[model samples]
Structures are given as C-alpha cells and as structure tokens.
Target chain A: MLKLPSVPGGAPPRPGTPAAEPASLKDNASEAAISALGWLDERTAISGTARWVMFRKVPKGTNWFYTLGTSTMMAFLSQVVTGVFLAMYYDPSPNNAYESMRHINNDVFLGQFVHGMHRWGATTMVVLIFLHMGRTFFFGAYKYPRELNWVIGVILVLLTMIMALTGYLLPWDQRSYWATAVGVNVFASAPIAGPYLGDFLRAGPEFGATTLSRFYAIHMLLLPGLIGGLIAAHLYLVIKHGTTAPPWIEAEIDEDLRKSEA
Target chain B: MPDTSKNTSPYTADRNIPGAFEGETVTRRRFMTGAAHATNGIAVGMIALPAIGFALGPNFKKLEERWEAVGRPDEFSPTEYISRTITVVAGAGETGKTTVYLRERNPDIDHEPEDEYNQYIAISTRCMHLGCPVRYVPASQRFICPCHGGVYDFLGEVQGGPPVRPLDRFYTRVKDGLVELGPRFSVNSELKRFSPRDPAQDLDALGQYLFPSRPTIRKIPGT
Candidate 1:
C-alpha cells in the first residue's frame, strides 16, 4: 500500500482507525484500466506530456477574451472541413467554375448552407484573430519572450488574407474576375521586377486557366499547409513560454520582487 | 521523510522563467551567437524574397480591356429585348463570356436617350446586389435576381428588393452594322451615366453607416 503525507492541521485519526478493505470487482476493474494506462504511459510518456502542456497553471484573471484564440482555431477547422467538401464538387477550370458553384449552391444537399458557413466562418476567423491580437497587444502579452510568437501571428494574419484573396477568385464571377485583375495589376506596379513577378503569378501575361489553377493550388494546398505549420509553431511557443499574466499581475509580481530584495 | 525532491511544483523558486535561460554574462561567445542568428535570419529572408515575388507576380501587370462584337443591329428585333452572350478577352489572356442584354428603343419615343448610336441599350445580366446573374422577365418587364429578390425595371432602375442601384451597363457602339461592346461600367445613381461607381457608394449616409462597404475594386488603391 502506498503511503500519503498527513495534512498539516488535521484532527488525529480515531484510535481504532478501520483496517483497509479488500478491492471489490468494480475497484479491480478500475485498477486494471489504470494499470493499462500506466503500461502505455511507461512507453509513450503521454501522461507526463499531457500534464506538462494541458494541465500547466495559467496566471489568474484571464477572462472570456482568451476564448477568442480558441474560437479562431475552431473557425479555421470549420474552414478546412467545408473547404474540403467544396473541393469535391468545385471544378478549378474557369469554364466550369461558375457552373459548378451554381450546381453546388442550387443542387447539392446542404451545399449552400455549408458554403455559407465556410464564407461566414472565414470572416469570423479574421475578425476573431484581430480581436485576439488586440487583446494580446492591450495586455502586453506580446512582449519579451513572446515576441517570436507575435511575429508568427503576424505571418498568420498575412497568410489568412492571402487565403481570402485566393479563394475569392474561385467563383469566376464578374466581381471576382475584375477584383483579381486589379489585384494582380497592383503587383505589376512594383518597380523593376514588377512585370516579371506579375506574369509569373498570372501563370503567363494574363488571368486565364493558369491563373485559376495557380490560385486554386495556392488556396487549397499551399496556404493551408503553411498556416497549419505556423499554427503548430505558435501553439508550441505559447505552451513553451506559458501565457503572460495581465499587466496588473505582472506589476504585483514586480512589487513583491522589489520588496523582497529590499 | 516526504519525497519533496520528486515534486515539480510550478510555485518553486527555481522554476523555468521565459527569457531567463541565458545567464547574465556579456562575453564574445554571446556576441558571436547573436551575429550567427542575425546571419541566419538574413539568409532565410533572402531565400524567401524571390519565392514571394514570384508568387505575387500577377498583381504587378496592367490589363488592357478589349472589345468584342456581339451581333449586327439588324439581327436584334426592335419589338422585344434579347440577351446575347459575348466572349470578351480581357487583360493578359483572360477570356470570359458576359451576357449582354440588348434592346432596340423606338426612335419615336426618344425625347432624350442614353444610347444615340443605334437605339440599342446593352445592360449587363450581373445583379447589382451580389453579382448573381439576373434573368430578364418580359411579362413583368423587370430583371429579377433569383439569388435574392432584387428587382430592376426595364430601364435597369432598382424598383424593389435589396438592389442598391441600377444594373451595370456595357459601353456599346455600332461600327458598320455590328454592335461592339466595351468593358462594363457601373451606372451612376444620381446622374444615370456610365461611370466606374460602386453601388455601395450610392447608399444613403445612414445606410452606409448601417452597411459598411467591403474591400472592392471601386476603391482605387493608394488614394
């Protein structure tokens, strides 16, 4: 039997403390399950890692604002789910792109709803991320050891914008066409290397099959892959450094440190 | 004795603190380490520059508009409006087919007309609300957007339902007997002229306040 330390201030156990009872069937089953987990944990160290990351103590005074990051993460996951569903029916060719969108919008079961969710979810993610960033800035959580995480976050913001821009062109509507045209033209205005760079992006000299293909590839594969890797890095950093305390809490800590030294 | 050494409490004084891993010592090794990090950063940035430039190249090129011939003026009937699809090759090498709504007006009823060339008015089929293709309903004499309930009159004026302004029109000209269509220009709300105005701009000040304008092509960059 394992022994536990006595409580600091507690009444002494009665003189006739009851002897330990034998394990019942239910208790045996639970013990067996715990031992199985222990066997796995011995090899994988899963329990220790989970305790270290998941159960780490965060500073007090965190409010609902902290939830924005999780909300953004959920929104991004929804985008990935809906985006995959969309890719199953969406044809990347300019010729069939609009027609496929029409078919999805009007024909497929719950297609319009899913598309709407993805669209609204993208906007929600953008807004939530911005709010999250604002909260971080206001709390000065991006200072000191968290600076690299902030830089990663800025990269994420840029990637999200690029994802939105690339996704906008998939509909092949007049708005998308003209908007993409103008968007690409803006890149062409870059000084000496502008024309060459613009041509490469368009996949030639203009927005055609190549442009659609490139944008589709970037939207569906490249940007998502990059964002996923960056998100992993961001989360790792967050866990590694731990969350920054609110300004008041930090100030209190500072005061305590100065007082103790004095 | 209690196994205090096994306890990994976060409240312990020697717990890891962020940015405090490096000892408080200024040495040649630290300077060299910082310089190495800076060099690695510059190397990574140099590699990233060409990749980003290549990926974003399309945004740098200017696209010129091209005109496409739809049909001869005589081919379209004066009695009823007809919609024709014309494939226009625009900027770089992008080709798209746009629906052009053509109707010949009676010269007798024209006290002041917008199209003086051949009494032919070519309106775009794209809805002003969200760019869904609006279908022409002859019985109701209105262009009805199926996506939403947006309705436009025969003159392309917004009669009801979510449309902010009239449908966009194509710059049409009659050369010889063929009707040549230019790039699309949205209609002005107050003047009813073909201009590069966004329908969002036509919203009342209060409406604008209620409905914020999204990033659109109408807002020119840098100004």
Candidate 2:
C-alpha cells in the first residue's frame, strides 16, 4: 500500500490550502469536498435511473429497515476474517482430527474462541440472510426488475450454507463422521444417481480422510470464493434497486386522518 | 395466463410520447425484477448448498463413537469366542504377563477364572488408517472406529471402510498362572479354521506378524 503524506501532528493531508490568502486552492478543496458529498447525494432520492439508481433516499427514507443489507455484508466480512484465522489451526484429516482440535484448544491461545466464533457465525449468517430476504420480499421489492438480484442473493445464501457444511467436516472426528454420513444418506435418497453420488463424493467406500480433505478445500476455498463473487453482485444489485417505502407510509396515512380531528 | 398484455386499459396502454417519454414503469419494473430474481437466486443457491456439501463430504464422525473400558475380570472370561482384548503395560512385556480369556466357560475345568490356564484372542483398537483407537460396538457387532468409520468384527477382521486390512490381534496365553498375551502377532488366513500364527502365511513371523486381507477376486481355498 502506498502511504499518503500527512501532517506530522496526525491529520488528513491539507498541504496547499492557506488560511486567508487562498483563492484557487480554497476553490479546489471546496470542489473536492462538494464532489464527495455530491456522490453521496446522487445515490439517494426515491426516483433513480438504471444508469445510476439512487438507493438510500426513497419515498420512505432511510430508517431501521435499511440496515439489513449492511448487516449481512458485515457478517460476511467477519466470516472472511475469522475464517482466515481458523484456517491457520484447522487440520483437514479424518484420523487426527479430534486430536488436532483438542490440541488447538489446549495449546494454541484464543484458538478455541476463534473456532467457536467461525462455527457459530456461519449459522448466524443463515438466519440473518433469511431475515434480510424476508424483509425485501413482503415489501414487494422483487416484483419486476429486481428479480435477478433476488436470484443472486439466494445464490449467496446457498453458497454460505455450502461453506458451513464443508467446514463441518474438517475437524475429522466422530461428530464430523456421522454428520457426513447423514449428509450422504440424504444424498443417497436423491433421484437415480444416489449411490454413484455417494461413492464419488466419498472418493472411496466411506467418508474418511479423503472426504475430509475435499470438504476442507470447498469450505475454506471453493464455496467461499463463490460467495465472495455473489456478494459483490448482490451489493451491486442493492445499489441498483434502491430502498422501498417504509411501513410508516400507513402510519402517515393514519396521522393525517387524526390531524383532521385536531 | 388471462391475456396479461390486454389486462391494461387502453388509457394506460397508449402513451403519447413525442420525444422525452420514458417507460416510467421501467425503474419500478427493474427494481421489482431485481428483488424477485434475488429471492429466487437465493432459493436456488440455498438448494444447491446441501447438494454441494453432501457431494463434497459425507463425514462419518457422527456415526463413530468413543470406546471406554469398563474393567477386566479377575479371571479371563470364557472364550467360546476367539478374540479378547487385554491391556498390557509398556514395561510388563519383559515379564511375559498376559491375560487370556478361556475358550469355554467351565467352572469345574481348572482352578478359578483368575488362573493362568486360558487362551484369549485379542485385537488392538488402533485404526489402520491413522493409528487412532477403534471402539467395540456391540450393537453393530463390529469394532468401530470413533475417529474414522473403520469396522471390524469379533475375529478382528476389517470388514470394510478405509482400513487396509484386518486389525492386529495379539494372541494371549496364561503362563505360570499369570494371564499373558503374545509378543504381538497378526495372522493371515488362506485355509479355513481357527489357526495360530502359521509360519507359512506370516508377513513377519519374527518382526510382528502383520496380516493382509485377501480380496475375493482370487479365492484361495481354506480361508
């Protein structure tokens, strides 16, 4: 990263803007500030174009309702950071899986907590994404042009679930074993290709070390990469769709009726 | 579909646009479409997730379990069976002290159950895949590994799973009234019958008799 020059006193770099004699420099700074603010302003307002859809300012205005998308993004970023840490200690093998995990708990500092957080946070992403989608749906946000974005969001959720499932097997212990067996059983219940699917997935007779390594790759790399792409697309769509009108529209209608009484 | 296009009234359908006439409904349509697709996309994405996970891994950790020894009897249990596991201390090998299970439960046969006049066939719990301990699963009637899903029966035969072959079984004999297991031996079977460490099929009769599983492709007689 190229570090920008800053005042020694610790401030944003304000080199040429003078206190009194400045004219063009002041104009330049003001122009820079105004343009920054203008970009923010342009992304708001109820009516926006496909060319540039203003999202924050809608008929309803930014309220508690607008936080869901940002919240989902926050959780995803947290996963990336914590997942990176967990990758440091997680061993992807079936035999020494439980022993390695125990070693992490007993030997490595803060390893247990990081592992727990990654485990629990993935679960929370499932919940939060559902809630976010629900919030978007009942509001009739996906009726027309937003359909593709809705699909992308769904893909994101599925990717997250895949990531979580793959992570589940990396521990390589008995719990990982049986859970995977149940998973394979579910797969075996699928249409015609069940048995072949199970064998192919396991890469052998049963879910063992080979299966663990495969899942670890998918969890730590494959699904996560897909998720990253989908999230980026999802955000792009969010910027395009803009916010929906709030429930307060009905409240406003009610307030107007009461105002006549007053 | 109820003639969706005709549902719009003529007044709404015809737009008098000279030059600057936007569809007006286009943004609304786009927004709604985007949301709809996102919702649908997520549903499909979520659906693929379980499928992807199962394909990637159907881990057996849950099916596996931990094995804990309740305790050994003062005397070897009658072994109408061929296999029995006895714990040997790291240092006790030199003393030739091994616990053996009697093949038949006979109270009147010879002294008490504690005497050193019995034989027990015992297999180690270690998994062949990673050397992790295997557990005795009576319900499944196989010695299952909690670490991996390796399965073994009473005869210490590795039935299936990732294990290369049957687990190592230590032959036990009571010598001088002290239950003593063998110096560690694995026996391969080509001929039928409960045979001891046969010199013919022994991979390492002197090293540590390790056995190999014979595939059914070439059916050798006896075993």
Q: Give the TM-score of candidate 2.
A: 0.46
lDDT of 1 by residue, B1-223 (tens): 3444664653333333333344433345576999999999999999999888766654443344556777887877655679888754443233556677887765653233454433567778867665567889999889998866889887788999877778877667787778877655555444244333333334433433333322211222221
The candidate scoring highest on DockQ is: 1
Model 2 bad stretches (over 4 Å)? A1-55, A61-63, A246-262, B1-223
- TM-score of chain A, model 2? 0.72
DockQ, all candidates in order: 0.06, 0.03
What's the TM-score of chain A alone for every prediction?
0.82, 0.72
Candidate 1 is graded, for docking, as incorrect
Q: Give the CA lDDT, 0 to 100, for residue B81 in model 1.
A: 75
Candidate 1, position A141, lDDT: 91
Each model's total of backbone clashes: 11, 60
A1-262, model 2: which lDDT tens digit per residue? 2233322354444577566764576666765665555555456642344346433456655567567877877888888898898777766665456777887778889988887787788778888888888888877676678899888887887777767667777666556655665565455433334434555555533344566677777777788788888887877777766656754465355788788988
